[model samples]
Target: MLDLIASLLADKELDCRLDHPITEARAAFNRAIAEKKTGPIKRLLVEDAVLVTGTDSGVISGRDAQVEVWRADFAQAGRFVYVRTPRCVLPSEEEPIVTELGTWVGKPEKADGSEVRGDYTAKWREVEGKWKLEAEIFTTVKSRDALAL
Candidate 1:
């Protein structure tokens, strides 16, 4: 019972220390993507941040490059509101780094029902009292074609 108590306290402390900050940062990122704005995304990522998309050859390295990729994608004819909702954030009691496990989806901005959903894992590090995303890897598990069935 004492171990359970300690575990609960540790979880609470972790939540207080990192969970809220990471949640806000992630929400801002999602909103930026939905709004097709890269500034917020840029602010939330580290200088050497990396991203692996849900497609082949999607290894995007560097914060500037990732922002450029988003810029190009935003300029495309048809774009979706990309959102990543975190399901769990691993605790880092002594370290400044945390792991976030979540699901991602590209929902059609219209009523097209062209949604592509996937799972993703992101690494975030607290840099100067701010949680900045260091790396994120996404895997596509469901596609638009699959959604129509």
Candidate 2:
């Protein structure tokens, strides 16, 4: 499962279908929740959730607070679990420098005629031989160019 998760993370660059990764991530997270293995860092969306954005004037202070932002986004959007993980690099390899941790930027046209571009990241740990997301976050990025329609 860890290997699958790793592949899914890299698939963003490979241009592979993201649905598989999202599905797997969702199932893995659900299982973790069911088994009560998500740890203190993770909680259901209803318990806490919010959305942080640059232009929206909303902000999530810290790590746990960011989780709430992610929860809200996931709830408002579809429920497929999508995560953009850290790219690991060997000493001889160069890594991509992302401004934020576990941040993924994607924009799919919304029916309302607004572009939603955001970055998301997930923290995962090996628990009981399976990788579970301990923390996850989403931050919205706003731009006049992006919003121009």
Top candidate, metric lDDT: 1
Q: Taking the tens digit of each residue's C-alpha lDDT, what string does model 2 give over 31-135?
A: 543333433325322223333443355655554665554455555542223324433311112322111133333333233343444455443433444433444
Please provide TM-scores, in order, for all candidate models, with all chains considered together: 0.83, 0.33
* Candidate 2 lDDT trough over 10 residues, lowest sum: 89-98
Question: Residue-wise lDDT of candidate 1 within 15-45, one digit each (tens)?
Answer: 5233557888999999998888999989999
Candidate 2 — what's its lDDT? 0.40
Superposition TM-score, candidate 1 onto the true structure: 0.83
